[model samples]
Target: MDRPRRCVLLKFGELALKGRNRPRFVNALERNLRRMTADLGPIEVRHRGGVFIVSGDMPQEELAERCLGLPGVSVVQPALRCERDATAAADAAVELLRELPGHTFAVRATRRDKRFALRSIELARLLGDAVRVRLGLDVDLSNPDLELFVEVDHKELLVSVERLRGAGGLPVGTSGRALVLLSGGLDSPVAAYRMMKRGLRCDFVHFSGRPFTSPESIYKAYALVGRLDRFQGDSRLYVVTFGPAQRRLATAGAGRLQVLSQRRLMVRVAAALGERLDAGALVTGDSLGQVASQTLPNLAVVEEAAQLPLLRPLIDRDKSEIVDAARALGTYDISILPDEDCCQLFTSKPASTRGHPDDLRRIERTADIEELVEQLAESAELFHPTLEERAMVSAATPASRGPSLG
Candidate 1:
């Protein structure tokens, strides 16, 4: 009549491959897990061999689900923990497996604690026999209808029947930080997500066509960042009103180079903001040849204005691939909503696919680029997409100090 205690088990993926720096990776993963689940009250993560046993007052499945989205975690299993005795383990396994649908099962046991009374094979046999006798199930080693795993640690044994896949990568904060040029579009959100999966924690900067356009784009960008915040907490979004700058570029008679010039100026503003925040790089959603401004030569022209490394995570991906990723990431619906993006403004002619950097420099000289960058950076409004202190995102900068068209 003994019932097993509920717990959660976590397994690593690439972190296990780190030979000498394994401890650092493991510690980071553990720390991230603890911080992610801190709202569930006091929780303890016990490292046993390659698995982490998480025990708390909350439901085991809930804990497992939360850990599934975290980076560096490969598998999450809602498990039952019992004393290190064959009878206890067998009872736990049977009780847990009763809810699962299967005619055949296999008990895979790992004895990390050598001091345990039974060997791994013996424990598996014992547990399998108990299931066969009590539950009337057959055993199939190679391809079983169900799988029951028993992990023997120094203090206890964990029995689980379900293994859930997790977000497999290095933990966030391990790769360093970057600023994402998040637009209210499908591709940029996916780009941010890809970078997050690669261990880069990101803040966001959005260019909005305010004073000349509606605030719809700002809402979409905020919502997109809010969705992405679930993967990495502490996300901030900076809004820079870019209508006036776009107008300046247009009136300067840089007709064919309008889009490229706007992109360059946007990067310049992002780079300036990134420098003040100590970010090492800037992330963009530019896929190669997706649009005129994203073409090879045009992209190079835009890159000329950035002070930091401009990372395009979606450079080689197709639009279909990017859309699929966005749908899977839960950002597609928000991104598809109607919005007036800054780039959509002031384009009277087709963008030049092969923009020369010298032409862009001449166009930029018509305006006080440094003063405009300073005003854009200083007047930028900040938003906390994930935290509780989030405020309403203002579309326009302060009237007294707003950057204007030259």
Candidate 2:
């Protein structure tokens, strides 16, 4: 006979506290899970109590990796389903424990279905003796080398020897959509990841220094979005040609305020794009004092250009923290790639650390700000990395299944 299908148990952490909006958040999480695991195979997702039970004939390792990228998921465990009986639960626990590498073990039994005869402690004691006798594994209740978790819910029982940590946060799409100002740098990608972790579904808008610079930045942006799409399943990137605007600012002699002027323009353009995409806000990688343009005064001046809310996820994080986050998100190597992004093309002296509103107004007068924003909005190129394309890319590259951030 064929073996029983492997199952994964998904637990929601903060989503359970959503009260009235719990259904909506749970639905969104279910939809995201379906999309993320579509390539795996035919699967079944059932909501029992507050837990999501996923069953399919796929590799648990791959499923766990995909689950960790999903927001709202706190834990994913490869589980075995059995009838709600003490002997069956003990058999399942012993079967799983036999495969795990551990001499000391513990059985944690949770009796969610109170109608069952035995309580949690009684069930644990009963299963513990059975496991110890069958597997000869010493019991370590305080700190076990391996833990076999058993959950009795209604008429079913699920048992697992290991539970993997998930990407804990609100489910993506539960918060809303935002357009991230994606740059070919470490910080922006990390910022985007942070927003995603907070349940924001992010679309990207990358400013490319094409024509005047190499296409390396554009490629880097593509790679970064590709990496991020692994989390969201689908992603859209809008590449806007920004060299003309930079040259225009240079020709108009913006002086020391060039960087600040460029930032304001980028914000305006991103705001325009955000409107078109119906994004709730604009996300950037600006950390306080990280760069000259990121100073408090310049940030304030630049904020005036955005019509919508501006979210800087990395505002207070230092460089080392940002780099570590980037590495964890798998974008550090790609971000470290040499590229002439729009921010690097212009040669200017030390930028003003405190850009005044009057200075911004004077700089705005040199260029038709409204016209430039409109032009960028009209001339941007959009790219959508579909699920099939992403799967193809993953299959072609053997390293796509490398260690997950979690």
Judged by lDDT, which candidate is best?
1
lDDT, model 2:
0.83
lDDT of 1 at 14: 82
Clash count (model 2, backbone only): 0
Query: After superposing candidate 2, which stretches have Cα over 4 Å from the reference?
Result: 1-5, 387-406
lDDT of 2 by residue, 86-195 (tens): 88888778778887787898888887788889999999999999988999999999999989898888868888887888888987887889999998799999988889
Superposed by TM-score, candidate 1 places the C-alpha of residue 252 at a distance from the truth, in angstroms, of: 1.3
In order, candidate lDDTs are 0.84, 0.83
